[model samples]
Target chain A: MSDTGQHSHDHTPRPDQDGPPSYYQAMETAVRELLIEKGVVTAEEVRAAVEAMDARSPAQGARVVARAWSDPKFKARLLKDGSAACAELGIDMGPTHLVVVANGDKLHNVIVCTLCSCYPRFLIGLPPDWYKARAYRSRVVREPRAVLGEFGTEIPDDWEVRVHDSTADMRYMVLPRRPEGTEGWSEEQLAGLVTRDCMIGVTLPKSP
Target chain B: MTARFGPGDRVRVRWAHPPGHIRTPYYVRGKTGVIERICGSFRDPEELAYARDGQPERPLYRVHFDRRTLWPDDQGRAKDGVEVEIFEPWLEPADAAMEGGT
Candidate 1:
């Protein structure tokens, strides 16, 4: 699928933009300018980095998930060393140790960073706005079932819900269970069913 | 450096509230849990945040805590567990206190 994720939507000033730039935003700009001034990093390199980050989307993670669903060996490798498994797919997770958790019949896993909004940005791109919000960062760990419920994901009482707190150097991604009735489907077709939210452990991939 | 804790070993998080850029969450402070896995160590985040080279890296473990134990309420199920990445400095052998007495 060659579709760029940039969809046309009504552009408007965000609610948070009612005031001046945040202190952290100003600090980032100041540091970036100083780095460019000192020739530490070129302006072109900065632009390229941002370009690469934006170019990344959930499709990369979807491909990895689809491959894992199709290949058991690859899945095992993925569960063992998430960073290495992702590298095999040519997805570079720079300076981050990845931990991929698989969702099974009796187990469900969710990812959160109670300290901050730490996410596998290299594979899935930047996190959603809500993921960075204080409410999500705080409440998800305290009341995961209720938070999952808010996302319309209902975990059965008998099932085990595992919440992964990405509090350190390790980043996490959920390997969602494949939908049923999709036998004989190609990896490309299977990838189409995996959504961003599915990889985030907020919801499950629906059968098509 | 060799890891102090291994998988399935019961350990308790350090209860001290020293100020710094800490990765250990406030909720898991002083809680007891079993080590799930040894996620090879890296530079101390507390020092790294202050732009210092956190030399002599410490071992980091993925401690698995029961969700109900962290939050004792009817909202969470018994099977639910929360795994947090904690450095060696913030953890101690839970059985350390029970030993050398009996």
Candidate 2:
């Protein structure tokens, strides 16, 4: 055997020793440490909050909205007032109030937080990585058709595409019209049709 | 905060330019349209991202635009229109309502 560490040829570091810490891990550690030092929040409380937050996914909200689209009575209630309407479906609007816009054959809806990334978190879970990206937020309002076209969505020549601006107090969600092939589908099947981009008004729902 | 504009109200998006600010896509600035709906109020992300949440809530409006108005080059169908959200601050009432009500 060679004298240099048994003549090993590999130079790459081991899994546990390789690479710099991730930004997420670093930020989390820093925030936790600071909180602990300041006594603003305990490590146990932080862990509990993170666990609870993770459990609050957007799937439930999507299901409620999808079911409402299939039910005329619920759709009517949603149109009347989304906050109360969501409650009827057992989905809490929570701290952020939301408005649900229904899209039809002649009318289409698109949502953007022109100033920032104001989104309907309750209905769609976390906004997609792209939604928070500068490329999308900056280009969406100015180039609606182009941006949507990139996502494989094309509004009809005669159909109108409406853009909803999300601001400080108000958040918006698009209730895309049910696709033709999905008739008689169950809520579970229908939920699959609801995409995060669709709810954000970037694309239409796909057939179940 | 209650919505300031209503369905069918005509308004224009105010041109905003901030140093090193990238926001509210440029093509839509100065475009005129009618309000379609009021999406409710929440913490403005622009403020929140800047770590300033003390500001009051701002009203969000859904505004509609004719396709012809947005894209002047006449190649596609004539009746196409687009709707986008605008804050109350970005809009001013237009002289007449379009097909929808204000």
Pick the TM-score winner.
1
Which candidate leads in lDDT?
Answer: 1
Per-candidate clashes come to: 0, 19
TM-scores for candidates 1 onward, in order:
0.91, 0.71
Task: Return the lDDT, model 2, position B22.
Answer: 34
- Candidate 1 lDDT by residue in tens digits, A1-208: 4557977666886677467779999999999999999999999999999999999999999999999999999999999999999999999999889999999989999998888899999989999998889998888788888999999999999999898999998999999998998899999999999998889898899677
Off by over 4 Å in 1: A1-20, B98-102
Query: Which 10 consecutive positions of candidate 2 chain A have the poorest summed lDDT?
Result: A161-170
Tens digit of per-residue lDDT, candidate 2, span A122-185: 6666777888788887667556678889999988766776666564466788888888787787
Say what the interface RMSD of candidate 1 is: 0.6
Return the TM-score for chain B, candidate 2: 0.78
